[model samples]
Target: MKHRFSRMGVRGRLLLAVLATVAVALIVMTVAFNYLLSVSFRSDADDRLRNLALDESSRISISNGRVTLPQPTGEIQEFGTQIWVFVSGATVSSPNVEPNLQAAAKSLDGQPAQYLDVPEQEVRLYGVPLYYEEERIGTIVSGLWMGSYNYNLRMTLLATGALALVLLLVLGFVGRWVLNAAFRPVSRMTAEAEAWSIADLDRRFEMGEPHDEVTQLASTLDGMLDRLAAGLRRERRFSAEVSHQLRTPLAKIKAEAELALRRERNPAYYQEALASVSQSADQMTRTVEALMAAAQEEGSLARGRASVWQVLEEASASVGVLAGENGVRVRVEPPLRSLYIGVERDIALQIIQPVVENACRFARSTVILGAGRNGKEVVFTVEDDGAGVTEEEKDRIFEPGVRGSAAEAAEAGGATSRGAGLGLSLARRLARAASGDVEVTAGRIGARFVVRLPTG
Candidate 1:
């Protein structure tokens, strides 16, 4: 039964529940009404029988223990009351009464005042005793036929039953209409939400402030869609950034391979080409690993702790080759106190290495890498003694494919700028994924990039 009920749609279940409650109430009301009506009919019959008996008793005359009844008067005849008088071992009754009822009245010959029923004759009888100066003379009995009352009561019962059924049907239709009207908005909203989720996640119900259940539901769904759309956007941006970052090294690797295959070169020349290919492969590996770590962080996967000092040392070492080629001295200034950050060792290295490499690319002579504690975060600052970033370019420099004046100047001066301007963007993105941020701060004589990560 429960399973079958559960299988019903929401509207069906609600309607069934409403109908059941109303049905119970209707049944109770019908029973109570009929019971009260029956009581009223019975009370009326009893009162009529009692009054008739009293009137007949007053007309009786008891002389020397003999009871006499007057001939039927106008009032008694018009009222159609049956009267019976029993005196001195004899019974006298009104004419035309059924034999069963006459016998019933005779049975009350010596009885005191009382009421009784003759069901077989549909009659109620009340008997009153007549006394003559403390001596019992006779008894007078009055009867009221209950045929008309019983017929009226039966008709009432039928009428009430029919009315109750009609009311039930009417309520069923009204209740069904009310439920449909109420659920219509919900159905439409649900359909719209499903369609939006599949095709247009940016679309929203745009209903104003929530003041009711329907509005509240719409608000909740809108919030969920917003989060989903943001996540999708982040995923797409990450893919594009990763592909862009890998292109430089991938092209370098391809160029080296093609050059090596183009000529029958000496062993030393081939070795140098293979070395270049190997370096590009290593760069590609680092780019992929860093992006994958950022992805894992965004997905809320498990993250490990790394020593701040160790990460700085690793970042400096990773870009040591670039710094040497560019005649830049990369210096790591150790913190006075031991510190750890809430990120994996490789992820921390990836986050800081890009900034250090960028500094090496544009540094005049010295690039300083340092770590310090900042409230609840570990802050790493990389400063390069080169053409400093203009105030207007600080934020734009971190945008993908957007380079600062320093890189464009180097390129215009016929100096090779190894960076494609994606490093800072990728670094900032990774830092944010780990609940941190990278920003370029105003420096005295160089561009100071700050990376902040949560403390372990």
Candidate 2:
């Protein structure tokens, strides 16, 4: 049942919900009205019967210790036609009055007012006592038949029920029509969304300004589409960049391999060619790995927010491990105020960790991490007290496969450079994905890498 209900469209559900509420209210009112009307009609009938009995009783005269009721004629004749009157030994019955009700009325002479049942009808009987001084002379008993009252009330209730049923049917259809009209905007949006394709990511609902719920919904869907378009574009750019960057290394590997295979050579010559091939493959691998991370953002930058200090702390811990292994000290300077950014902590760490680790890997003694709020951006700094970038190398330092001055220095000094120049490239792409960037400048003591991201 629940599943069937869930399967119903919004229009059907809305119509049913409204109709059901109105139907329940109508039923309650009908029942209560029937009760109130029935009570009033029966009471009126009882009063009419009692008044007739009183008039007849007043007309009677007592002479010489004998009671004489008026004859069933004149004004009494009309009244007697709708009531049952029993006075002493004389009795009068209404037309078609039940013998059972007459007998029940006689029995109620000394009792309180009560109802007597006859077949499918009822009679309300009221008894009055007549007395001479302290002695009881006679009893006046009267009753009104309730069959007509019951019939009229039953007909009224039946008509009320029929009217309610008609209203439910009418309103059910009308409500459905109204609801469908109201949701027409949503239907249009659904159709438009269904027609959308990945190839047409730029096509948007573009609901200009949010006014109502439907407009708000359209605007939200457009926002989601915007994110999807941005992500797809980013992925495409990353793929293109990866292909472009990997081509040279792949060509080098192919040329070297083909050249070495062209003729037989000594072991030392073959070993040199194999090492060159291995280096090219390693460079290509690094490029692919970095580009893949840049491509697979998972909508994290668009949907997440975290404290800037927390991200710095976590990034510092991650870089600290690599720093300790390299005999370099990592120091994080506390910010003056708590700052939050639009990027998630893990993603911020992803973007910052690479740059910080690169600094720690190249640092002579210590690397300092610091952060501060600058206008609408959260700026992060990673400074290494090591050989800084030369004026010529700073221009193309963030480019993929550029392996700048630090890598050059490490290579010249016979130290292992941890990356194939993709770390800074990946870091810059990550920062830009979050509406920020990574830039390098000559610090007072060493090289400084600055990352700026949107503040929350």
Q: What is each predicted model's overall lDDT from 0 to 1?
A: 0.81, 0.74
**Tens digit of lDDT per residue, candidate 2, span 23-122?**
9999998899999998899778777866866776777677886666544432222443344444454554334445665576567665545554444445
Report how far off residue 399 is in candidate 1 (Å): 6.9
Q: How well is each residue in 1-456 modelled by candidate 1, as lDDT tens digits?
A: 999999999999999999999889988998999899989998988888878777777777667755567754332324557777777557654545656777888888898788888788677888878677887767878877787888898898899889989999999999999999888878888788667644485788877789888789889988988999888877867787677656556666666688788989999999998887787788778778867767765644226899999998878766655776689999999999999999887677768877888898888999999999999999999999999899999899999778999989888999886677778887887788788999998776799999999898
How do all models score by TM-score?
Answer: 0.68, 0.56
Q: For candidate 2, list the clashing residue pairs, or say none.
A: none
lDDT of 2 at 65: 69
Model 2 residue 98 lDDT score? 50
What clash pairs does model 1 have? none
Name model 1 segments beyond 4 Å from true.
1-4, 73-80, 111-114, 119-121, 203-238, 297-425, 432-456
